[model samples]
Target: MAINEKSPSPAPAIVESEPATRCGSNTPGLAATSSNNGEKPIAHASLEERAGALAVPPPSGTTSSRYRWLVHVQFFACCWAMVVAGWNDGSTGPLLPRIQEVYGVNYTIVSLVWVFACVGFLTGAIANMFLEPRFGFGKTIFIGACFQFVGYAIESAALPFPAFVLGYAINGVGMALQDAQANGYVSNLPNSSTKMSFLHAAYGLGALASPLAATQFAQLPHWSFHFLISFGVALLDAIILAAVFRFKTHDECLAAIGQVRHLDEPSEKNDDSGSETEKSHFRKVMTLKETHLMAVFILVYVGVEVTVGGWTVTYVINERNGGPSSGYISTGFFGGLTLGRMGLIWANNKIGERKALVIYAALAIGLELVVWLVHSLVGDAIAVSFVGFFLGPMYPIAMNVCGRIIPPSLLTGSIGWIAGLGQAGSALFPFITGAISNKAGIESLQPIVVAMMAFTIGLWICVPRDKVRTASPSSSSPEGAGAIPPPPRPVVNV
Candidate 1:
């Protein structure tokens, strides 16, 4: 593989100096001058050439102190959306019995709500596969909020079960799109793994808030009121999201995060050279093998996480004799999850993301075993909370790892595919649980949870440990100069 380097200082306009490889010249490396300024001459490269450069590992000790604050802000923006979605989605578990009582349906039929939501997610994930490139991250999120608002609005009307399902399905579509794109965008930035932990913590916040929210909403006498409140929140989120869209960046999002010194390009004596150079530099991302592996891992992991959250409420209600108030059990679980993410911020700072994931996975399986053995409601509550705590970092950590393992160019699509796979799993498992509970007995749910956790443990073994290398701006640059490494490998699936 060969790399084409261009000088930072502008050169005199000329017919040609030397012919660069057909596709090899387009990439503006980390050292390349601002694309906005004509000071740095741009070069074009073929996809293969760009991929080759992307494949080169970053040197260790590279950090993004400059962009740290901006990363956190963007992360929080994504987190706010997750919190809203989690509140809407996780609340279903606690509200199921009420819905069943009001609608006069069986438990199996009631669980179908999750099926509708999962199906919608699947649709959104698939849609994101194409939409992400066209809309960019900001617009994709706003669109997702719109879908969620519509879904919530539809559900608020208290229509028949079929109508409810349709509405939930619509919401899922928006969530799936926002999730894939937001996650893809997040995975590409510096310190992404840590940022991911912080970002997912917001989901825990929403999840924790949900049962409480439902408990309060239940006091309102009409479920429609609950949906109305949710609708208002979703509308607000959409507005905030749309305003956030104005920050999109080219070349790198570095400017958005305040990492760059200037936005304006040096006044170029005009030529079509730079624009042509950048367009050619755009590269194809995923190889067939990488794509397949990503799909498998994500499918398995999401099934485990969602299944646990979705069923924990049911298990408490059916097996432990918990009432609507027992919905607090779900809160305990998300409480653990929230705490775990906070703890991970400290843990990751000490040992880095890879080691943190290894520890989190082993502990999660152990907690699941506790849930398996303990038959009492108290025991179930403890086990579920522990499960939440341990599983907290998996999604973000896995995403961080994926970003590192794959080239940046393929990031948006790769993240979308992984998210889609997870949504597919989500769609499959809740439906399976509904069907299984109808026949094998609700107790079978315990074994299903155990099995999913075990499968995740096994999958962890196949994931290659991330290797860190020290990166230099260039051979001539002295040590200690600032440099940002590529994204880390994904450790846990969503």
Candidate 2:
């Protein structure tokens, strides 16, 4: 096999000097370009193009059977770790009231946990650029494990308010690191939509279990003891990852999974080649229209999910006059979320991704409004659960769509930022809601959620469609690489 960049007219790389656009004008679903005669469907043309592109491929050796076993190990172990992270995510909101009671703090002060967690996650996401390039995948994940273990150890010690918040921040960084890596890695696999859905479902499953356990454990004299369970699980996950992936490096792992073909490895003497490769990837990733649109969409989606999870119990008990027994309703919301991710994988695929997203977003918005407008606690609880159910499939679906649109060369870094910074929703929106509640009342979660849902629908409309255009007659049998798709169109419907 041979490798060469010989497309007749390649799309120019986005220059570093230009800022990336915030949205694109392409149609809602797949990006497409009609055939010259306008007789063929864009999807069909895209598959043909992909086929031709695959025909003149770069050299790559087949993975041995050992690689297969390790791949399974890596996948299951990463999933185990994600489950622990999910447990942390779900338990927090339920335990927040207890923490506030223990520390004698108000809503505004208690919200700092989300803020600190946000900071930690963002820090870790940015740190990936330096960490993966130097330490590679296995060692880098090991570092994250250390951070989680140490952070959990601190939290389990039952420290002061500030100290406990600090522990959360540290653990946030660790979890973000792992989360970003796992999502990116999963997106490149062959059955990505299914895999991503299942991966996140595991997260949801763990999330479902967390609130149930936390509500039980949080009642006694020690609220923080609930975290000890999470700590033990995290420790076990760390050991699994370390044992399975000890020697694998960044390039090694991607190659093992077939994502390494898009970017070539530079020879030892040409250090500049590596730098140039990185720059080119950075250019495509930042410049892609889908990258920005998906980022903002996720920002809103995550904020909606975490905000509801984090503040629902507070809202139910305080604003709706529900009791501690009702606080466990947060798990119902999370249970819907888990089931949605698990159950909706087929529906999402059946309808195109864009339509599926729009449908779910609309459903979530309406249900959330019911939770807001209605005064009954039981009614609100049911609405919140349904809202979570609709909102469940959003994250993994968004990530899967993103992987399809962005060039393969930029997958890891591009996804790293998307998963990391997009997660700021986990902090920013919730913090804003908490602050507003401090002033106006906890009733504010309703409008914030409604507005976010509206924003989500509009943003999905602006996402670039995935399609392929026909080549001119002269280049009918292209010599080398397939042509790159055109740059993202202008913002259309948004």
Candidate 3:
């Protein structure tokens, strides 16, 4: 396979002497420019040019110190946003009983919150496809935050049941945008596997802490008080995003992280082509077999994760005859999830993402069985936590695989679809559980989770294997000055 001879022109008018590949290597073409020492030969170069010069393993050293600092700050903001998302998702489990009591609703009625949220998730996912290209990552995230703020505000008011469910819908839209962008952004960074783990670990931390707060808040007359805390956090998240991103466009954000490559050349001939191009990319993403498999995989995975977190409190209280502190079981689950993400980085690497997920799924199935069969409250609680622990790493690992296999051009939209649709499971399965529990006992939760886990293993097996790329040590390092080696032709087995 031969590399393309023509490098795509940058947004600006500057021309490159040598054609470069997506992996940041110069292919054999024309004479090399003498100014290849991470310095621009042309003054007033485009942001794409600057990014090209800095290259892929992510620029480090004195020259990019400020850019590095900005990346760090931006990551912090992303993590904070994830925490808020986790808090929102995790809060519902502990508050479910209280919400039912206040509204005088049954299991099926209370589950409407998640159903409405699922609708919001689908809406947000579709909106993201159009929004990011037009509004840029910064504004897109801020818009999501604003939507979340509105949702939290509505929920905190403790409105009618119908209105309360509407809030979850709005909140779902906000979370979909942030989740897609944050996961896509981190996966492109250096040491992505490690960073992606930590980024999601922050989400786990938020999920862990929220139950503790929500359980206490459930004791109050106004159970909606828990959302007030989320309202404040959402406000803070919006502010941080606005300040850090400064409303920069998508290309500008890519330039900041040294990932600008193969961006669509801005056409003076047809200004409207940008939207058309986005549509084309989206169409291509839809046609790919990998995209569908991944979407279903994530959908099932998230469904199981959220179902456990959201319904565990009700399960404990009703089945185990537990006290008011039953919410702690939810906290224990997310705590194990957070610990697994942070602690299992080495294990993931040791076992590989594809094989490791199967093992994790199997372990989670066994744990779910323990939670179902065991009558002891303490024993069920411990099993639930371990179930969360094994299930924790699956999401990040899936995201990492998607980043590797998907083309850079389609990455953002593909991820938006994957994350957004995947989140539907978060609502879809939970809603199903509740509706079913309305007829069957809440003990049905374990069987549904176990079935999803088994189905997830099948989905994982169907996903395409990542293309193998070999990088020289110098190119792999942040500080090494050697030219990056050209990537070999992609070889797809089966």
For every candidate in turn, the CA RMSD to the true structure comes to 10.0, 11.1, 8.8
How well is each residue in 368-463 modelled by candidate 1, as lDDT tens digits? 777767778888788888888888877777777776554344455567767766777766777788788878877788788777777776776677
TM-score of each: 0.76, 0.78, 0.83
lDDT for each candidate structure: 0.62, 0.69, 0.76
Task: List the candidate numbers ranked by lDDT, top first.
Answer: 3, 2, 1
* lDDT tens readout by residue for model 2, 1-494: 22234333344322111111111101111122233555543333454552333232222323334344555666787777678777888888888888888889887888898888889888887776445545556777778777887788889878998999899889978887788777766664445678888888888888888998888776878777777888888888788878877646644454443332321222111244455644544555567666667778887788888899889988898888987766578789888998999899889879977899899999998898888888898899999889889999988888877766655435566676777776677887888898899898898888887998899898888878753322211234332123434333221110
Candidate 2: stretches off by over 4 Å: 1-71, 254-260, 264-289, 467-494
* Candidate 2 Cα deviation (angstroms), residue 9: 20
Q: Is candidate 2 or candidate 3 better by lDDT?
A: 3
Q: How far is candidate 2 from the true structure (C-alpha RMSD, Å)?
A: 11.1
Identify the superior model by lDDT, candidate 1 or candidate 3: 3
After superposition, candidate 1 runs with Cα above 4 Å error: 1-72, 218-220, 247-254, 258-287, 348-358, 467-494
